[model samples]
Target chain A: MDTFVQQLINGLTIGSIYALIALGYTMVYGILRLINFAHGDIYMVGAYAGLFLATSLGFAANPSAFGFVVTLVGSMAIAAAMGMAIERFAYRPVRKFSKMTTLITAIGMSLLIEYLFVFFFEGKPRSFPQLLPNDNITLFGNATISTSQILIFVVSMVLMVILQYIIYKTKIGKAMRAVSFNLNSAKLMGINTDFVIAFTFALGSALAAAGGVLTAQYNPKIDPLMGIITGLKAFVAAVLGGIGNIPGAVLGGLLIGAAETMVVGYGSYIGIPSTYRDAVAFAILILVLLLRPAGLLGSNVQEKV
Target chain B: MNWVKSIIVGIIAIAILYVLNAAMSATGFFGIGIDDYQSRLLVFIAINVILATSLNLINGFTGQFSIGHAGFMAVGAYASAYFTVTHGKAIETSLSGLGETVASSIVLLLAIGIGALVAAIAGLIVGIPSLRLKGDYLAIVTLGFAEIIRIVILNIDAVGGATGYQVPGYANFLWIGIFAIITVVVIHNIVKSDAGRALISIREDELAAEAMGVNVTRYKVTSFVIGSAFAGVSGVLFAHYNKFLSTNDFQFIKSFEIIIMIVIGGMGSMTGAILGAIIVTLLPEILRLLPAIQIGETTFQFADLRLVIFALILILTMILRPQGILGTTEFTDFFKRFRRADKPTGGLE
Candidate 1:
């Protein structure tokens, strides 16, 4: 029972990271309908920026929790700017083009960003120094949780609440909602559609950056290629929870995380080794796509035909 | 006058390439037997040309974004490798207590056929569901399917799994060249056919094409199957030439490389596919020389930054020319004056 609870906690912690990343995917898809393949790389950039800020500035040796927050915020800010730049330079020119062209361009941009990171930071995985307590505290008989996991869960929940409020109550949120419904109509209504789209990218990218920082803290070791899998998995999460729906992304992320852990934990008995855990997400994606093209929470907006 | 000039130019270009191949081989440049390597590189370029051009049939001409080309390649590679190893002349002779040298003459075309068949089957499975989706959704699903196929292949121990499989090398420059010529000819014929026109119609507007009596789903599936089958054939060539196959070799990165070739060359044109394939394949080799230059206490090697620099180039190309280098134009189309001189006056411009 304790082991199960512990696993659940770990799953949720990981799921929280996925949820944050999935939010970016869902938001972009909701409005622009582009998958923004580079979103994952933006998260990677965020982690690296945090890593540079923490290590190069000597925050690693005697880091406080407050100092970690400062580094994270600054890194996310940089990532947000990067995301905006990508939108303007790589995506904007192809805005009026066919979705195929834009999709290919997005992929090219994803590759460019990944390779840029690879060039700057060698391909070797770098370790981030522990910024949280390593010691675990027992809750029940043996249901123990680490400080980092608790922090991740707490931060994730807090961010979700803040995001919920921003999306629901804010003026920009209203404009975003209007844009998601109809871009042409919203533009005629005096909404700055371009600014909203850029803000969406920046905001989504910033959330992903937070996820990246938290993931780095949890795993401690990261490389340029790390974002590819994380991005892919989050994409799956976005699809599973009914893309373009915020709450659905969270649910999808948790479900996927739990499913992945369970597969790794139990798949050994079925002759499928734990090493194939990476593939479970992809298989699930194919299955979901085949069975339910619209996804769990996605609405079917019919063609006028 | 134009025909004579065109033939002369073509002969000169081939002569130049041949001379360069010989000179590079004689000089031992780049330490990899440049002559042999260049010939081999040219063959690989042809194989890539075949794969990229075929993919363009679906992605560029038919207007579907299927990113599982490598999965089809894997299907073809393993299928061809299995057939050649199990039923080829060398294997049959060795099993009958005959020397490997005695069985060299009998060629096995079945390997290529089987490879393409298997790839087509895989394509059918992937395409059925994908026909319902479009754009990013389709891209994600195909990407997922490719990864799933790779992982499944890696876990299936019978096919050698993570350790990889090795087959007898049977491919040569002449055979590859012949296959390349066949690919170009076949695809060229297809592109000029009524079926090709239907595909172009779908690319322009799927709904309108459907209304105009074109079976949208059927055309899409046919394009996908044929494209994937060609990719499989390319894989078979690669497996035979390399004499080894691994699941890693058919990963998403390779699929991206092939896609880049199509995107850079001009998505819909066969000649553009070939042009793109050759340049994309050769650019990395060219970039290898860039690393020898030292920069401020740290030496940048092409091996380290090749992908990054290459990806940047891809981005720039897309930004500047999203339609690609040739933009659906054939090599002959560039020289309109010469072609116009021979054509009927006041024809379709």
Candidate 2:
């Protein structure tokens, strides 16, 4: 029972990260109907931004909870700016082109970001500076949680709550919904669809940035290529939750996180090595795509003939 | 007659390239006259050409967004690497000197065939499930599938596991050149055939093609298998050329690079693929000659900034010319406009 609880804690910790990243994917897909392949790199960029700011601003010179907030907020702001810039420069011009073209451009953008980081920083993984002092607290029996894990869960929840409030209770959120439902109709109704799209990118990127910094706290290792697999898993999570649905992204993230942890903890009895844990997310993606293309919570839409 | 024409076209194309290489790199018919860097670049160009042209079949012609092509390449490279390391050794030793070269060459061809076959099987499995998906969804699935392949390769110890494998070298410019020609010719022939039309129609509109009895699933699978087979052939060439095989070599980035090649060349044009291949292969090497600067005690290398420059070029190119350099047209099509004054508006549509 303790083992189960321990596994659950671990799963939720990572699952929250996946959820945070998936929100970005889901939101972007909601508006543009694009799988922004570069969104994951934005997450990486966010983490790097946080690292740079934390180190350069002397925040990491001494460990304190106040410094952590500064790092987190700084990363989010920088990532949001990056997200908006990407949409304005890379995506807007190709918005009127083929979906295939936009998709390729997204991929190109992903490569560009990844390689640019690699070019400047080299490929070695850097140990992220700790902004907050860490300690472990036992919950009950052997199931204990670290301060970093607690930070991940609590921060992600707060962000999600804030996001929900924004999406549900704000004028811009309503405008976003209108634009997603019908771009031309929204424009005709005098809403700035372009600005709404950019806003969605900003919101999504900020979440991904949060995920990035949060994960860095837990893992403390940052690399340029770190986003590829995590981003992919988040994509799977979004799909699992029923893509384009906000609540669904969170649901998918937690479930995938739980599934992956369980597979790692207990899969050996079934002759599966823990090394194959990386594959679990993709396997789930394939299964979800085949079994429920619209995802668990997604309503099935008829294919246009 | 078409086969004959294709063979002629292949020979002419290879001959032209051979002369060009002779002048550019001195890697003509025989001898080790060419510098190592130039030869490596030339061989890589041939390999990239194979990858891009084959990818165009599924991506450009059939309009299936497959980003897991590196998965098939990994399958081919590993399979052939295993074969050459195990069976090829015996063939190499059974003959003497020049006879050994002849025997190994034949054995290498057989090994490449096996590699292609295995990769084709993998492609069939991937393509079947993936045929139902399209566009962005398809790209993600293919990518997921490729990552799975990489993980599996990493686990299996026989092919060296994560440590990687080193196989004997058997590839030269001539061999890669031959296979590249074959890939281009065979794919070009298929693209021009009646089946090719069915494939293209599916790309244009799957429902309409199915309504017209094009058997969309079958042709999609077929194009995938053929393209995968050639990717395998390129893998075989890559494995033997580099004489080393590692799962790291076939990462998702490789697939993206191949996509960029076709995208830059013009997705739907063969000549564009070739042009794209040459540019992508040579760009890094060409950039390596950039001047290095000294800042106090530090020597900053402008050469190290090539990938950054390369990426900027891709973003800028996409923004400026999203249709690619050729824009779905061909090189010969341009000259043909002048040759025939009466039929001016016609080109490969």
Candidate 3:
């Protein structure tokens, strides 16, 4: 039972990170109807950005909560700019073409970002500096929660709440929702569709960057190639939750996180190795796709003939 | 008479190519044989041509976006390698008096056939259910299936798991050239067939094609099967060329490289795919020719930056010319145009 609780905690912690990234995926898919394959790389770029800022801004020297907060926001700000730039330069012109074209361009952009990072920083894995001092908080017998895990949850929740406020309460958020419903209708209704789309990219990328920083805080080790699998898993989470649905993304993210943790934790009893964790996500993706193409939360629409 | 003439022409072509291959290998200046790097390069180019053209059938002509070419390649590679590694000696031993070249080439062709068959089965598994999902969903599912195959290979130790397997009876340029020709001929014929017209229609518009009584799902699966079968052939060739097998070689990145070839070459054009295959295979080698430069006493190696340049090219090409180098025009388009000029009603086509 204690082990179960412990695994639950571990799962939710990872799930929260997946949720943050999935939100970005879901939001972009919501607005653009694109997979935005580069979104994961944005998460990676965010972590590196945090690493850079933490080191250069003297946050590494201080290692305080304030330092952590500053690094997170700074990374978010930088990633949001990147997201906008990508939309404007890489995606905007190709908007008139086929979805497959946009998708290939997204893939190309993903490769470009990953390899460019490898070029600039090389492929060396770096140890992220700890901004907040971490310690294990004992909850009960054999059920201890680490401070880093708590930080990840807290930070992600705060960002999510802030995200909710911006989306539900702000004009741009309504505009975004409108644009997602129908682009031309939104334009005819006098909503600035382009701005709304750009804003969606910014918001999604910022969330991903936050997820990146939080993941670094928990794991400490970071690499350029790290985003591919994680981002892909997040994509799986988005699809599982009924893509384009906000709450569904979070639910799917948590479910995947929990399921993956369980598989790793208890799979040994059934002849499943822990190394097969990556495979587990894809298997789930295939199963989910086969069973429910619209996802758990998405409503099934009739295929237009 | 026409059939007889074509068959004779085909036989003569094969003989001429066989003699040329033999000469090139013997001289090493005409510079063939498996021992030399250039010969190896030619073999790899041929292999890519097979992979790209076959992949183009599904992704380009059929218009289904699949990125799991490497998965089928893996199934082909492992099956053929397993067959050859285990039974190659048996065939060679049984045919001890058949001469080394004859027995080995026969064994190699058998392995390729078995590999392609196995890969076709794999394609069937990944395709039939997946074709239900339209467009991008199918793409993602195929990607997932590919990753799953890789992971499964990683666990099962019979095929060497993560460590890899050793393969003997390496295939040569002559066999690869022959098989490459077969793949091109098969794909080109498929594209010109009546069924090929259905595939093009599906790509043009799925709903409209379905409305026209086209069996959308069946044709999608057909192209996938045929495409994967060729990928299998490429895999057997790849396995023999390296004389080794590892699951690492068939990761999703390889699928992307194949896609990039088709993307660069021209998606639907057979000539484009072949040209794309040639350019993609040679691009890195060409870049490797640049000398390491010393800028302010710091050595700059262009080799490390090749993938970065590739990524840049991918992005810039998508932005500037997403249709690719040849667009939809085949090299044969020129001849077709001349023939049309010589006539009138055929010009409508």
Candidate 4:
């Protein structure tokens, strides 16, 4: 029972990160209908930016709550700018073309980001400096949780709440929703669709950056290629929850994360080895896609003639 | 008369291949020798042509996006490699009386058959269920299926698991080249047929195609299976020629590379696929020849930046020429246009 609870905690912690990233994927997909393949790389860029800020600004040497917040916000801002720049340059030029063209451009942007990072930083993994003091709290008999894990939960929850407020309460948020509903209609209604789209990218990128930094806290190892698998899994999560549905992305993320941890925690009894962990998300993805094409939360719209 | 002409053409092709093979061998054609690297490049180009052209059948002509082609390729490679490793020597010995070259050729043919058959079956399994999904959904599902296939292969100890697999080298440049030509020809002919028109119509509009009495699902599945079978054939050639197999070779990046080829060449254009294959194969090697730049105690190698360059090219291509270099037009179409332009006075017509 304790192990199960512990696994759930671990899974939810990972799931929260997936949710954060999935928000970005779902948001971009909502408005632009493009997968935003580079979104994952933006997460990586966020972590790297945080690393740069933390190290260069002496925050790594003197870890404090204030320092962590500053580093997090700074990285988020940098990633948001990068996201907007990417949309303006790589995506906007090809937006008028076929969906395939935009998709290919997104893929190209992803590769460009990954390889450019590899070129600049080398392919080796870097250990992210510990920003928070490490401590474990025993929740029950043989069940424990760490400070970093708690920090992940708290920060992600706070950010998600902020995201919710922005989406529901802000004028720009209304514009975003309007554009996503129908680009042409929104344009006719006097909404700046391009600005809304860019703002969506910025919001999504910032959230993904937060996820990256938070995950870096929990697991300090960072690498240039880390985003590919995590990003892919998050995308699967977004799809599972019915892509373009915000709440659905969060639900999918949590579900996928819990399932993965459960498999790792107890899959040996079912003849599945731990190394097959990477396959778990994809397997779930195939099953979800086959069973629920509209996703769990996404509504099925009739095809127009 | 048609049969006679086809037979003559087939014979001439075989003769040309035979002479080309002999020339590319260790000795030389006359005294001009093609080096190992050049021959290897040629062989890879042929294999990639088969891959790119086959993928084009589904992605370009049928307009069903499939990025899990490497998964099918891996299935064929591992399946045939296993067959040859287990029973190849026995078959070779059994056919020893036919002479060494003939025995090896027979073994290779059987291996290719097994590989293609197995991969086609895999295609059927993956395609039928997933073909119901449309556009980006289909793309992601295929990608997931490919990942699952790769993971499953990684777990199986029979094919050397993660350590990689070794098999007899029964493939050569001649066989790969011939198969490449055969694949392009078959796919081209299919595209020119009534079914090809149906596929083109589906690409243009799926609902409209179904309204026109086209069996949308069946044609999509058929094209997928055929494309996968050809991918399998390429895998067989790759495994035997390379004499080793690794799951790393069939990763998602490989699928992306194949997509890049078709995209760069012009998706629906057969000759464009061939051209794209050649360029993609040669681009990395060409990058290797670039000089390293020395800058203030640091030397930057252009070779290391090849992938970066490749990505930049892909993005630029999408932005500049979204239809790719050929835009659904074949190289032969250009020649026909040129000939018509030469005689602008309406000569024959």
lDDT of 4 at B81: 97
Count clashing residue pairs in model 3.
1
Model 2 Cα lDDT, one tens digit per residue, A67-150: 899889999999999999999999999899889988987887888899889977888999898888889999999889999999
Predictions' DockQ, in order:
0.61, 0.70, 0.73, 0.80
Q: What is the lDDT of candidate 1?
A: 0.83
- Judged by DockQ cut-offs, is candidate 4 incorrect, acceptable, medium or high? medium
lDDT of 4 by residue, B1-349 (tens): 3335545664677678778788886677886767888889989999999999999999999999998999999999999999999999999999999999999999999999999999999999999999998888788888888888899999999999999999899999999988887787788778877889899999999999999999999999999999999999999999999999999999988998998999999989998899999999999898889888998988998889877987898999999999899989987666675565556543322
Error at B344, model 1, angstroms: 5.3
Model 2 error, position B9 (Å):
1.7
Q: CA lDDT of B6 in candidate 3?
A: 39
Kindly list the per-residue Cα lDDT of model 3 for residues A1-305, writing each as its tens digit.
Answer: 88999999999999999999999999988888889989999999999999999999999987898899999999999999999999999999899888888888888888889888987787999999999999999898889899999998898889888988988899988888888888999999999788888889999999999999999999998999899889999999999999999888989899999999999999999999988899888888888888998899998878665
Greater-TM-score candidate between 1 and 4:
4
Q: Superposing every Cα of model 1 onto the true structure, what RMSD results?
A: 4.1
Question: Candidate 2 DockQ score?
Answer: 0.70
**Steric clash count of candidate 4:** 0
| Model 1 spans > 4 angstroms off | A1-3, B1-34, B86-108, B340-349
Query: Model 3 misses residue B331 by how many Å?
Result: 0.9
TM-score of chain A of each: 0.97, 0.99, 0.98, 0.99
**What interface RMSD do all candidates show, one decimal each?**
1.7, 1.5, 1.2, 1.0
Each prediction's number of clashing residue pairs? 1, 0, 1, 0
Q: Which of candidates 3 and 4 is the stronger one according to TM-score?
A: 4
| Runs of candidate 4 exceeding 4 Å displacement | B1-14, B338-349
Q: Name the top TM-score candidate.
A: 4
Q: After superposition, how far is residue A217 of candidate 2 from its true place, in Å?
A: 1.1
Span of ten consecutive residues with least summed lDDT in model 3 chain A? A296-305
